[model samples]
Target: MRVMHVLKTVSKAAPTSLHRSASKTSTRGRKSPVQRATAGAITITHADRVVYPGESITKGDVAAYYQRVMTSLLPNVVKRPLSVIRCPEGARNTCFFQKHPMGGLHHVGTIELKEEKGSLATYMYAKNASSILELVQFGAMEFHVWSTRIDRLETTDRVVFDLDPSPRVTWERIVAAARLLKVQLDELELTSFVRTSGGKGLHVVLPVNPACSWDLVKDFSHAIATRMATGQPQEFVDTASKTKRAGKIYVDYLRNTRGATSIANYSLRTRKNAPVATPLRWEELSKIEGGDAFTIRSLPRRLSRLRKDPWENIDSVKQTLSAAMKKLEVGA
Candidate 1:
């Protein structure tokens, strides 16, 4: 919708309280509109239903959060193929992960994607406010995006290094691992950004030239992970083997592969308190306590107070894997 609408809602916002307006009162023999909240053209049904029971956060509250963050969220997700987690009843209830459209929602549009089996599949994407709100209406809790935009499906424009920490690993070590990766990336003359995965890890992302193939991108990422694990065997592991992950951080490079996805920035996680996958400045990492430190209830305040976006320069950054690739190949 309008930018003003987004600004107004966020400026005068809080987690939706439990009170209902008089207009929302039900009439005899008539369906009540209390359960739905409408913006300009989009409507979120079950607005009063509790999605996060622990926080008493309602569907409307989630919708409001999306609206408030849409300016920031849309850039990372719009026009990208998505795999969403839908919690139909609520976050505490049954949830299913979906990549292709199953024929219910109209606002969330679908694109034909070529699958590995040489078959065309319909993948979902949201271009604007209505489509995003439609997903909130569809009970979508988390949004994951592929590395490439739909326009350039085979050409990846981004690289993501997911630092998946073992349960025994402390948050401090996780932070340290990200900084170390940053140092390595810096040495290669590549600029990178960082964000919380909203789970147990951090994602170091870099915007790359879209000319690179998925194979090249994935190989480069694997090289970085391998080099890190080799240099610091005591703190890092490169493989996905669960048994080897104990007391270390797993540098998950697989998300750079074709069709792989990472949680989009500003997206909510399907967790208690509705934690957000938040982006932070490198300096802010040491100050932040955990990956799930910022929830839907607290993120708006943080956003309002921030002087500049942590990833403000991400879109302007232009780099390729060319130089980095040669270094890894020689090192190998």
Candidate 2:
């Protein structure tokens, strides 16, 4: 469809109140006739690519999807620097797009140029390509949005150890790893927040001072993972190889990069379009079914009444890397 038509469609879809929380915004750019034809209900902003099973989304469609998500799933993360990328037409191996680090792939360490740009629309697509690729590998087929703002940096001094069990792994094992993580973090007096990955695993996020570099964070994560593996050999897998991780948990420390972004708490999953990663009270861990936490489709509604965000006061909490590391050594 044409891009201009898509712009008009998105304008109609724009939320009446730009001030309304999560409401849509105005479309204030000139467009070509091509943009007018294939407009959709949503507009894609800061996206690298849009993947369709048998067709490609026109520029208009891209813009529409951007607006849709901004109006729908992205208000919280939107405050961060933003970009978008669209997937090409007739693409089959979504996994191939995801694993590749070049172009729009999302494996990690992919870069896109925004300042040296052509059209603003084109730049948005280029910047978000890599992130879109990663989300697609996780069963996402739509436009993937991204933010590059350094201000999004929340924890710098704190260390996070992500415990992810392989698919088909038992929930009991996942919980056991979580229990152990709580003990470990508590002993160090490093407050932590635990949330489901929206898939099979759990992410235990800790807020820390931002003084340390990524290398230190990596070291701390590795040390904790090693300790946890030694203490619970059967339940936690410490190997760096995929083949050796069978019947065990994997400790993922890659989320410590400077621009790294996790799917936000209470964010939506575009594939199932369901709510995923709902925040939980630590007490609810044992009560709810393993996968009952939340998904994309249900999160916005839930956030209306949520009084506290898990990471709300993360910045104010004072804890040093030295103290945290020492606590780890004593298993305090």
- Can you tell me which runs of candidate 2 are displaced by over 4 Å? 1-158, 257-261, 270-275, 330-332
Query: How well is each residue in 1-332 modelled by candidate 2, as lDDT tens digits?
Result: 31110110010333321111132344765432321222222223323243332344222333333333333344333333322211333123322222112343332333233232332212222223233323333333333223233343333544455677877678877877887888877877777767776667677877666566666677777788888777777766667687868878988776555434455444433322232555566766786566435633245445556676645665577665677777676763
Number of the top-ranking candidate, with TM-score as the measure: 1
Per-prediction TM-score to the true structure, in the order listed: 0.90, 0.59
lDDT of model number 1: 0.84
Clashing pairs in 1: none
Instruction: Give each model's whole-structure lDDT.
Output: 0.84, 0.48
Q: Pairing residues by index, what is the TM-score of model 1?
A: 0.90
> What lDDT does model 2 reach?
0.48
lDDT of 1 at 328: 79
In candidate 1, stretches whose alpha carbon ends up further than 4 angstroms from where it belongs are 1-33
State how far residue 84 of model 2 sits from its true place (Å).
7.4
* Top of the candidates by lDDT: 1
